[model samples]
Target: MSELETLNWQDWDSVLVVVAHPDDAEYGLSAAVKEWTDAGIEVSYLLLTHGEAGIQGLDSAETGPLRAAEQQTACDIVGVNNLTILDHPDSMLVYNLELRKEVAREIRIRKPNAVVLSNFEVEAYGGLNQADHRVAGLAGIDGTRDAANPWAQRELLDEGLQPWITSLIIITGHDEPTHTMDLNPESVAAGVASLEAHKRYLEALPHHPKPVEFIPEVLRTENGFAKTFRVFGV
Candidate 1:
């Protein structure tokens, strides 16, 4: 296999991570978030759903707010202070025009150099990619384009949102990654803590794997801990 390319962190001053649900970023990207924040890069999170249906036997009403709170704590651990959780139904996400416009609005508001998202592919190395994940990723990709076009979402412009285009889109959980970012020891620790912050969510899982055990493996690189992404230049 060809070697993965190195992501040039210096080129990005800020990033807006758009994902389907809570704890999504913590799975693998939080380490990169910690690393970037340590370097003084601004990072924000935009969750399309609160992951209300992630746990079985849990009412979505209660689970929604609970997961949101957990996500906020997770973000805090990873040094992300800005977070927005939209009220989209879990497991029923659709990459429709409305969703695309919503994501575009956030992009215009945040004005980041790049956007990060989970993989949109049908299957991942672990198993079938969740429906919400796939939909959100596809919407995120289109949203970037919509944000750049003033005519695409004219109502947003009327509402005082200006068109903005990010330089790149970075997708995690890809079967094939194009770029990798090495994480420092501090970042690795912070990443572990970030996932651990999802206490209730992890507990609800049928199998509870400690964050430290899985995080290091997910973030592993030839040199050390790292995070990988499939980058698309916009």
Candidate 2:
């Protein structure tokens, strides 16, 4: 693995962010995303689920829409206007044929040169990272390749969705990463604002005496300084 020198940032035209739930990109890669967008790159976000399973006291049926709405506001804050949700059920996002096809279709349509997502291999806070996170990450990577291969999924071609292959894949949350992009001050602010937008979701967590503490830990932790990701193929 090699960490390429800081990118030109001005050359990228389009980027696609794929994650398991809402706010995943914002917390994981919004900083780098800001720089890309500022450089005139079009950033599209594809979340596999609406994160309805989040929340400690509210019903998922109710919380899902709320979280999704929050995600919209968060993306807007960070200058990302293109967002899509697969609306898959939370906690049970299966890595099956249907999921892969849908993800592939989106990739084909977006045709982004770069992709960003959370790490699938890292264990969660208690050795239990969200199952959907891992499922989505694996599927997103596979979907990128599947999207570009005509023989991979005939049904997609029949549906008029062409295949697409992204040039780069960046995975956040990995302790040892190949690339670290130093975020600018504007992006750091955007990251904080983005996480704050997830009001309902943050309140749902069991940790912290109050919901206010979530922001500091998230934006100021060891993983907070520079956005790190594994760069495949170099």
Candidate 3:
């Protein structure tokens, strides 16, 4: 087996996690994110949407701001102060050059050594993944390439965004994870708090599980609390 089959990178100073909506990271990755923050690593979250359409029966105009505020609070709980939310239409994301360019631009701006994203599989985590998730995941994967190649996203050059090659990519929710990192109780509790911070969104979600109960279960593994990932470019 290759060494990458058991990968663990501890030298990173900066990381950027890009996601499709609010609470995406908090679903399970927040515990790990909190651990990184505690280690003094710079972690920023770049959301592709405001999650305006996340709430049922609520107008997107209201839902957008509400979700944005909730996501902000969630970030604060996890020690992630730098949050960026794009205005891409909720539930209508497309994997196009426009999306790629936007993600690449953010990569250039953030200049993180590592980029984190979630599963992009058509069917993920025991259900069909959201369209925005697949699109956003592709944006993170391909956008990293676009950001690395000055010739790919030529428009970014005009905007003074330089090419940036991420040293690693960490993809959560892979069927065959390359690595698993243990999490402490403090970090897991922070994750629970972050998820709970989405008060309105969680309430609006149909039959949503309770954060205090749900987050801990999600983080549980055979041995102990942990987060798994499929690492690339390690």
Candidate 4:
């Protein structure tokens, strides 16, 4: 329980958020995203999967497009206009070289100073983390490095994307966070709205109660609603 450092969001001009599924960012990061976007920081989302296998009864064909739309709505609510959903299979993400390359390509193209990622650890304060989440987080870290190395992913260079080094990486939903971002009341409300945008998806989860209040409730702090992250530098 070391004192968490405060992240100066204004220091970075652009950030690219990489996550496993549709609602992943809305869980906690959306509050901070609201704060960042309000300050005119450019933000983009790179979702590895559409969370097609999230709903129990629905098949991939139905759930994929539905989840994608939900994610877009959620991002829009949080003021994120750039959202990209990759064709990676939901619930079957792997932290392999190919995945790293795909993520690196996005990093190169975006050239963000900071990258936000989901927790890669096996467990968080909430509970055991999912396989897809872990894979995506791990791949994001590797991709951050690969994006800076010209020889690492040569195909991206051939595609006219130049190598770019990211300055910071922030891992949300960490068990022990090193940095925190305090959110204003408006940011908290926006985060709630962002999660609520996933109406159909939230309805499908039997365990989720009061979906709109979920994020604000879980991430509330004494100062204000806050999001925490484990910071890494490149």
Candidate 5:
């Protein structure tokens, strides 16, 4: 087995999953998340947007709330306790000071040892891997750094959120990956089931790019056995 495939991950105490939409975490990491939670690790979620722009037949006014509620349901299935939605407009998410400060504040509050996000460079998976995804990823990287900078969000510091940093980052859906989480047969099944919870959001309209069969296959091909990530310097 490759080093990433064999490395043990039972020591991590907390994990923060940051993704572009509501069901993104369930689609990619729910199985692994279950493993972490079962191991006593605190698992939290940070969804960058409501995916309001998604869905074909419905208007954004209607689709947004439906998608948001669907995402919340998915989180409940995975045993995620802390849920946060940036609520940024779907297709228009941008990388900026305001967004950066928001993400940084979450980092400071959670202090997760490991962070997970969609691959900024992925080309196959359409929506989750967008300009917004890259923007969110960059914000997360900088936020972890700025979390410790005394000047970066002094107001937050005053509230006692304090400076904190994640020790590692795990990026999904890359052609080449640096690490992998062994799913075991049960975990893999759980992951697949969790993805199924987003049934409505994935099958309804504009967002359902891939059918059911294709979804798992794509996940297995793009993010199976071992996932990939770039570790930022400490």
Candidate 6:
């Protein structure tokens, strides 16, 4: 394990967050995102799915649009510049060349200097991780590299989407994070608000802890609020 250090974003101009579901960003990386956007770095969210399978009792037809709307609302709270939702099946993401290409397309289009992603480990927070998250995270990693290699996705060149090399990839929800970011009260509040935006989804959970409660509890550090992440440098 590497020694934990304060997250470094001194040179980052823009960031792209990739996730499998609607509230994944909120649970995993929202506070850090709040801090980033507050510092004037443009942030964009790329969701592989509309999170149709997130609500237990809700049908996909209803859950899809509902979650999408909530995700956009959440994005607005953090000053995210843009949001793009793809048609990948919820709870069924596959880590294949196709998935990598799709993610690469977004990376190329957005040309973000840094990318934030969900944890891809087989286990996280001391429990088994979901398959979709594992797939999405792996895809985010590969796609970042793919976006930098023109020959990896030749079609992107035809679409006028130039190759982009993301300098950093930040993975949230790891048990042992390599980096940490201090969060001010305002930033933490913004993150809470963003999580609360998913009213329907959160309400549908069996025993969903209120964002205000769990967020602060999880983020509380010795001095103040903070969020940790595992980082990969590209």
lDDT of each: 0.89, 0.76, 0.88, 0.88, 0.71, 0.88
Tens digits of per-residue lDDT for model 5, 1-234: 344443356888888888777777765578778777877888988988988887777798887788878777777666778889987988788888788788778878888887777667636454445677777777777766677687897788888887886777776665466666655545556666676766667677454444345434544634354323434444
Could you estimate the TM-score for every candidate?
Answer: 0.96, 0.87, 0.94, 0.96, 0.85, 0.96
TM-score of 4: 0.96
In candidate 5, list every pair of residues with a backbone clash: 56-206, 180-226
Displacement of residue 214 (Cα, Å) in model 1 is 1.2
Q: How accurate is candidate 4 locally (lDDT)?
A: 0.88
lDDT of each residue in 1-234, candidate 1, tens digit only: 579898998767789999999989988789889988878888999999889998788898999999999999999888897899988889898778999999999999889999999988988758888889889988999999999998898899888999998999999888898998888888998999999998889898858779999888878777788888899999
Q: What's the candidate order when arranged by decreasing lDDT?
A: 1, 6, 4, 3, 2, 5
Candidate 2 structure quality by residue, lDDT tens digits, 1-234: 554454334667788888988878765477677777777789999999988877767888898889889999988878887999987888899998788788888888888887776878758544867788899888888887788788997898888887777788777776557766766666777777787788877666646333234433444534445566766630
Which candidate would rank higher by TM-score, 2 or 3? 3
| Tens-digit lDDT string for candidate 3 (164-213) | 98999889977778787888989999999999999988887668889899
Clash pairs (backbone) in predicted model 2: 147-163, 147-164
Better of 1 and 2 by lDDT: 1
